[model samples]
Target: MIKTIIFDFGDVFLNLDKPATARELKKHEISNFSEAMLQKNREYEKGLMTSEEFVEEYCSSFPQLNSEVFTGSWNAILLDFPKHRLEFLKRLKREGKYTLILLSNTNDIHIDWVKENVEFFDEFKNCFDGFHLSQEINLRKPDAEIYEYVLAQHGVTPEETLFIDDTSENTKAAAELGIQVWNIDPAKEDVTDLFTIKKDLF
Candidate 1:
């Protein structure tokens, strides 16, 4: 009776180099992610801070790095979105078997990068019944409230929804709220194999 499938944008569908950002930062001698820096990121993800403010905060603190360099380093984690995944998603949508929703903890800059880099970004996005970006919704995963918001907004029962995310912490939170979850490992599995991988659920 799973009528809804909630997907995380990065890693789950679109490929992401999870450690690329840190690696890029290290090249610039910016290794430490202190508590304040993490807080700023959280605020940015929650849409509490504007992109200008977020970039400015980082650029100001690291005087050696300009906005462009810092932005590039920050966006290094985003990689290619496989065409097969988009095809899979489109097929799923065409089937009309379930409500497809996309939920991601993403910021303005990374989203901008995706739009510019991913040729079929909009087409892929059109498949989702509801597209909830953390920055737009002002809520993020692992925070319970965001899951509640999506469930409430869509009138979806947690038990009847499957959430796929590459992050364990995010899946754990959704599972706690009674949503079925696939905590996918990007290295080994691909979202395009949804039917074969989670056949039992289907």
Candidate 2:
């Protein structure tokens, strides 16, 4: 009885190399960010800080890098976005199978990069019933509150929602709220596997 589909953008749709940016920054000696630094980065994505502020903080941590290098280092995380996924999602939107929503933990710098790179970004926004970015919502995934917020905002029953994500922890969070979920691994299974898993529903 799932009446809605929730998706995570990075690993679920676009392919992101989590290590790439950090690795790239390592060359610039800004590579040694601790878990706390990562947590702060997530805070920025959760709309707790602006891109300029986030980059400045990062730069302050490593004064050797200029603002340009910091921004480049930040953007390296978003390696590539494929066209096939865009087409697939567009098809789903056209089919009107369910209430489609994009719930991603993303920030302004990366988002601005996407807008500049992807020709379909504007169209992709139209595909979703609600396109909620953690940076915009001030809430990030793996947090129970964000999931609850989306559920309440959409009037969606937990049992009536299916969430697709690349992170097991993220899917687990949604599952905890009684939503069905799929954890897709790009290195192992493709996002298209979601279609096979949910074939009956479609």
lDDT values for all models: 0.93, 0.86
Look at candidate 1 and give me any clashing residue pairs: none
Q: Which regions of candidate 2 are displaced past 4 Å?
A: 200-202
In model 2, the Cα lDDT at residue 34 comes to 84
lDDT (Cα, tens digit) per residue for candidate 1, span 125-198: 99999999999999998999999999998999999999999999999999999999999989999998888899
lDDT of 2 at 89: 86
In terms of TM-score, how similar is model 1 to the real structure? 0.98
Error of 1 at 77 (Å): 0.4
Please give the range of 10 consecutive residues that has the lowest summed lDDT in model 2: 193-202
Q: Candidate 2, after superposition: displacement of residue 12 in Å?
A: 1.7
Best by lDDT: 1
Report the lDDT tens digits of candidate 2 across residue range 72-176: 878887867777888888888888878999999899999999999887889888889999999998998899999999999999999889998988999999999
